[model samples]
Target: MTRCRYCNRPLRSARSIALGYGPTCRARALAEARAKVIAQHKPTTIERAQELIEDGGIVPLRGNRVWRVVSTDGSTTHKTAGQVHAWTAGLRGRHTCYHRVAAQLVALAA
Candidate 1:
């Protein structure tokens, strides 16, 4: 007897047998896949954002006060505005903002 790949139950319906999983299992699988896609589109961290900028993967949007960054994983995540949080570079407690980091990156390249 053919078994459902997901629920591991004996396949009863011809459609379920052909698909290898029951309707409920199929629905669960689809929901999980969608959730994974959504999770992959979450906001990126400052370090990841810097790497994206250096690799030319994204351009910071010009804003009045702060900058914005999107997910580096190539997903359509919403643009996350800069939090003005300072990041330490090898030094404890010492930190700077994205604007300063951008300038530093440019200076390093030039």
Candidate 2:
């Protein structure tokens, strides 16, 4: 007798025997797989930007409507417009980065 992979119950049908899972267990396993995929998605850029602010990586330049943001790795610095909330070091041509997002958050809080 073939056994279900999930519940370990005997499989009576030919299709179920080949698939290794009974219909109910197969559906449950698929749903669990989908949920795991959703939960494992990569974190968004905004979260990194938020971390920068929390780490005191953002600073206001004196006598100007500009802010300075440090890179996450501390290898570079970028300037952002205080009012417009745009940064220089962007990923591709998106014209936005964690620095930009951090600037926007600071602007909002002020």
Candidate 3:
């Protein structure tokens, strides 16, 4: 017999040993830990951009020779003719977005 380090409950069966907590206590603790991890690493601007582009949820609109990519979240990136030309030339087979560009730059560094 052993007591759970977290809940101080008597652990007798294999199931209890595996959980190391009473069922209710184990579930609550797991939920709390998951929330903490999520809160710690909330999505960044670049991350949100990558997600939008990867999902094909951004639409590119052209006006007066300028290009703009708009996301459903109302985020928009305006590009000059030169900037758009350079981006298309450099993108090759990879995806491109003003938001995702920063994220991809970070990912490459990593």
Cα lDDT of model 2 by residue, 1-110, tens digit = 88998999999998898878898998887777645433433357567767888999989885335788786679987777533444433534444565666665565454
Give the top-scoring candidate (TM-score).
2
Candidate 2 residue 93 C-alpha distance from true site, Å: 3.1
Worst 10 residues of 2 by lDDT: 82-91
Ranking by TM-score: 2, 1, 3
Please give the distance, in angstroms, between residue 75's alpha carbon in candidate 3 and its true position after superposition. 25
Which residue pairs clash within candidate 2? none
TM values, all candidates: 0.37, 0.48, 0.37
The segments of candidate 3 whose C-alpha lies over 4 angstroms from its true place after superposition are: 44-110
Give the least accurate 10-residue stretch of model 3, judged by summed lDDT. Answer: 101-110
User: Model 2 lDDT vs. the true structure?
Assistant: 0.68
Per-residue lDDT tens digits for candidate 3, residues 1-110, read: 77886778788778768867776777676677545433444356456645655665433444323434444466654343312423453346353344435333222222
Clashes of 2: 0
* CA deviation > 4 Å runs, candidate 2: 1-43, 62-64, 82-92
